[model samples]
Target chain A: MNDPIKDFVEQHREDFDHLEAPQFNLAGFKASLAQEPMVKKHRILNIKPASWMAAAAVLLVCTIGLWFFNSTQQTKKTEQHLALNKQNKHPKIAEKPLVKAVTQNAKQTQFAAHETTSHVKKHQSKEEVPFIPSPDQMLYTKLNDSASSSTRLAAVLAIKKSELISYDMLDRLAATIQHDGNSNVRLAALSVLEKYRQDAHVTNLLVNALNHQNDPMLQLSLVNLLGKMQNVKIDERLYALVNDPSTLEAVKDEVYQILLKENKF
Target chain B: MKLQLILLFALFTTGLSASAQKQYKLAKNNGKLNLNISGVTVEGYDGNEIIFSLPKNEDEEVDERAKGLKAFNSSGFKDNSGLGFDVTVRGDDINVNPVSVANQPKLSIKLPRNVRVSFANNSNMYQDTVTLKNLKTEIDVAVTGNDIVLTNNVGPMNIKTLHGSVDASFPADLKGPISIISVNGHVDIALPASVKANLEVISNYGKIYAADDLKIAINPASNPKTNATGQPVKTLTIGKGVQALTIKSLAANSENQDENAPVFGYEGGNYAESLNGKINGGGVDFILKSNHNNIYIREKK
Candidate 1:
């Protein structure tokens, strides 16, 4: 248990215990769309700007190139953080203890961490199950890369980890979701929000998008969240939707049922 | 000569005077009561005191009873005179009619203020309404072959009969838990909004419904512990801050809440063993079993 890998796993377990994930919106985004006006558009591929298929094809092609692009970039931030804290040497600030422990002794520590995790998953699964970065992270890393920019590479790696605690990672993820993401990636973001849906600070933002969004697919994702809640009192936004004549009949009915089941109606 | 005959008749009358019927009374605390009965009709009375009378029978197995012999005249009758209630044998079954208050049985003992009661009738038919009231300090009951009516506002109570239907009424502010089970019969129970308890109900071949403004919370996956220990050992504790209530029909995964939320320390026993179909709810720990019956579970807040 004294081992750093085990210690980190324990800490991870505690962090996610009794956690309620904050929900996020599921829709297309536009980064800096409201920021700058002047821009020079590049004409590389012959396709309409609104043709999502063409953009997806381009992303599929870019995937191969970005894989190698992001890995080399990840160590740079760790190196930067390491250099800044070199004198203090805050071991706790390491981005991924499992990863760091593995790198220190890759094969041995990974085996030990896995052994402890298989047994400790009762509570620890709350954190580990959700944060186990998806293949999308790897794909995101592969597609979005410039061999020279280490910051962009760091973002790519952080996407793979899905444990991005810094604004740097959030901004990059937000930027990627906004500008160049494929439809599948956009949908994946919505699905991933279940792990973070209960975070109070971000839940309202997610709820606002769900309430206002016209996309059928995004609405479906929002509807699914009704099943997960138990302890928290029903949100008032949903209360209005149940009776609001302006809302769609089906959505209104769904909201009403949730309210009725909770006896808030 | 006439004077001599009169004097002999007077002497015989005084010498052979029959004994008056005897009555013996007994009182019991909260526990089981096994009564032996013969030609006894437990008449349902509305008042607090249970009254008894020896029936006048024209024909019966005991010739003494057939000749209108009072129960107190019998040798075994306990004379509980002027007490709360009395148990007496009656020759005619007409006194145990349904129109009157012939529902709840009059038992000897008094229960706690808030307690759960269950009735299991093996033979004969009886019917009456059992009420659980606001001042539910004691539960008095009777049973026969058929139906049992729970007209009293009892505590977290259970009423199960092997062959009769259970029809009971609960108080608007029912502060205690309740469970009524009956075999080969239908059960009908209603609760008000103010009643809060985890309702694990079962109506083996019958329908169940709670359509009023009642609030029953159901959380099956809320705390599903899948192996792995070292945490607070997630237990499906119910009945905390709730008036105790539990009912089951088969050996299903269940939890019985205690009636009183008293302090408890782990005695050195197999904790996991006790966790078998165990859930903590209400304020009491109930040991429930379901054997061949349709089961239902719900929570009303």
Candidate 2:
């Protein structure tokens, strides 16, 4: 069955050999192989730009949403704090603005000083300057707002150690002596006020404190303090105390002794 | 059968009434207890609740007329605790006030050991003494005419009374910053021998008595110089070049010992107008001040 096809091929063999086979071209094949990737690269480049923009838009939206949520939470926390402070009716909370003003002034002073200094000095001083609550604020808050009597007593003692006694601080001390429920705190306040006994305002405060004071110890202290003053005009008040039935016998005796010593009896 | 039922009903009613009057207890987790009512004896216990009850008297009987009726008076406080007081709890603070000021009862309060206590009675009509016992916390007491008796307490106590005496007995290990001021009454404090304290006793017009066992070191006056008139002079050194001279009278001295020594009556103890000394090398501040009454500091036996 194959004899006919074989005979035909055998007959065409000389013709096929006489025709030259097509020459092999390596450079063209290499160029075509190189051009295949360029088309794939262009296709990839054309597809990526829109996806990148969409991803960037999502990131920007997420960041804004997070910032907005954080700011709202902060505002809510501040509102809660203010409301709680109002309910507590604590004077220290109410005086936060005063404290802030004092800190702000201190910061301004530091800023002014920094302006006059070199960068190195500024950095050194910034590290050195710590925010300390002013003595006035500390005394005011502790004396007025502290629930512990010992803390108030400590505040009075601290005021006693301070070299400078402001007029406002004196008034606060006087108020403490007059109105503080704890006798020890009142006594401590009295001791602090004794330093300013020579001042007319303090003398008046002391003289007036005797009438409102029912504690025999406080009355005695007031009498003794006022009696020691050089020109205090408390003789009439002393007589009044002697006449007042509410005044204790011990206080009356002290007043009498003071009057006798002064030759005003 | 009817008789048996009647007997059972009577028994149940009696039990109910008995249980009703037993005690008023409020569960508490250690904080402060503010007692504005007088005539209360506060004792610390290990239980985690506050118990308020009237002191039992064998001869006392409940008023039949007061049954099913709350105690009412002009004080305007309702007896919510069923112990003749209005007990309110705010946060961790428990406040106790008498329902009727006119009918101030002798209440016994058993508190948890960790709770601090503050008692204040400013009314002159309520002169019943207040007692605190077996407490190991800070105590603040202010009363007008009622005596304060403290026993077996370790404290950072501040007790002030206008005309009331303060008698305090401390445990062996005394914690302090203890200040007791009685305007016209005596202050008697007994501390164990092992206690270490800085004791400052001031009796302006009275005497200070101390037991012999306490080893007290009296501090010297800042300036001991006396002027020509025999008045004590205090010379304060001011700034760089200033010396402020302050003349204080002998009468101002809390310890006018020289003048009062002849009248001292204690047999084996020391007596002075004022005494500022350290007991057992001085650990905590203990101040006792009285204007017109004596202060007695003794060692606990």
Candidate 3:
């Protein structure tokens, strides 16, 4: 080798080396391009003379290896992305809507709102009315609103007009009490319901507030409702609470009066 | 609105002023006091008659001012005209002048062709017994403050009194829905053996003695019904028969009447004796109701 070639090889030696170890096709590459294109006897060739061919051949092999490696890496990434999508995405996403029968079946077995929640676009129900005083507002109106007074007054007047009660209105009143109204309005509602204990959910609501609600006055109204209902279901449920001692005298007299009316006196 | 109220006040005031006239009456025929009032009705074969039962030794008196039958002394006929009527120059003091109206007194009158008695002048507080028999057409009789006795053939009878016992002899055949009432008196009725007609009787006080054949029924109360004071009411209808006999008695039961009998609808029916009202116990298809009274049902054979 010439001195210039030797110097060039020594200086740029690492660039020509592979990280794992210099890899190359010495026989196939060097031998082919070693002799002239016409010389048959001279099989081996000098690398210095075939530097361009050697470099070109190496570059071509690297290009092919890089293409295969990158193609394989892309395939593996695709498989991983698919696996993650399968594992992480919710199962419902693949579902086509229940053709027609499922839609038809949704109409029945309506469950109450705020009850038995499971993720389903269940029936959209009329808002749960509170069991309150008004026939329309089953739930009590929130006293927090400025209009609650007027609404509550309207409810009272409507209640006074007749004895028949609408349970839905009571529910609304209950809801209003739970969410909107002041304790006082709710207490008033309870007083109005004093005569009716057979009402469905309202009594339960009143019973629930027996201890927890802040309003102390509501207890009396609740007791009044419980007693007047005359149902053993209610009266017996609540142990006898003596409210008006003076009434005991009247009750004794009442027994006499009742006996007299019965002609037993 | 104020003006309207003022007008209503004036209208009521005028009505009150108009009702201020206290009623007064005079006799018109020959009776115990010679009063020819239509209250004395005849049933069969007898004409119109005016009668008055006088107290023993209380000479039958005559009020000369009575519209008719004056001349107690002037007539050759002794003051004792020997007529069915009696008269005394000096008679008992009568608060009212009893007289029968010249014309019909807007009353139901049944007069037979044989007997005829018109309005005459007389004085009397009560006529114990009065009969106009053989009445076929019509008759009108009125009496006040007196115990009246009426007997006649099947004709309409309207008897009224202030306070006295009423013994009305009605021909069993006398039909036309009999109605007997007393403001304060006992009503004794004799129904004919065979008769079917509605009867309505009322007495402010006193017992109801009726013929023994009337039936009783109880009325059912209507739903959402109200008593007198807007309270829910339970009503009763008691009695039955061809006649819708409605008997309303505003009578405070004497000791014997309610002694042991459980009385319904009468607790509130007893009227104050001062009220001097009536208890009704006879009628057909009639409604008998009294604020205070005792009602008895009787049947006629």
* DockQ leader: 2
Q: Which structure is stronger by lDDT: 1 or 2?
A: 2
The sequence of per-residue lDDT tens digits that candidate 1 reaches over residues A1-265 is 3699888888799676878877653432344553334342334344566787788888987996796677556655444322111112334434453454345344445556667777888877454422244343444564475321222323343343353232233334444433422222323344333333444423443565555555323343354353334444336767655656655444555566567766777
In model 1, the Cα lDDT at residue A89 comes to 30
- Candidate 2 structure lDDT: 0.73
- Against the native chain B, what TM-score does each candidate's chain B reach? 0.41, 0.75, 0.42
Candidate 3 chain B lowest-lDDT run of ten: B270-279
Q: Write the per-residue lDDT of candidate 1 for residues B37-92, one digit (tens) a residue.
A: 21122322233332233322234245454343332323444323321123332331
Residue-wise C-alpha lDDT for candidate 2, range A1-265, written one tens digit per residue: 6798889889899887887878889999999999999999999888778899999999999999999998687555433322111112234644664554455467657765655564467456454444455667778898985567877776786787554455567778888988887888888789767755545566778888976777666887888767766677787789989999987777888789889987889
**Candidate 2 residue runs with Cα over 4 Å from true position:** A1-130, A134-140, A158-171, A195-205, A211-216, A260-265, B1-21, B57-65, B172-175, B224-272
Per-residue lDDT tens digits of candidate 3, residues B1-301?
9999999999999887645422212232222222344234333333333222321223547556763543233223222322322233334211112222332121222332432232222224424344445543222233433455555545433333323445544555543323333433455555454444443333223333333233332222123332222344332323222122222221222333333221222212332111111123333222121112333444333
Q: Relative to the true structure, how large is the alpha-carbon lDDT of every model?
A: 0.37, 0.73, 0.37
| Candidate 1 overall lDDT versus native | 0.37
Please state the CAPRI-style docking class of candidate 2. Answer: incorrect
Q: What is the lDDT of residue B1 in candidate 1?
A: 86
Interface RMSD of each: 26.7, 17.7, 32.2
lDDT score at residue A116, model 2, on the 0-100 scale:
55
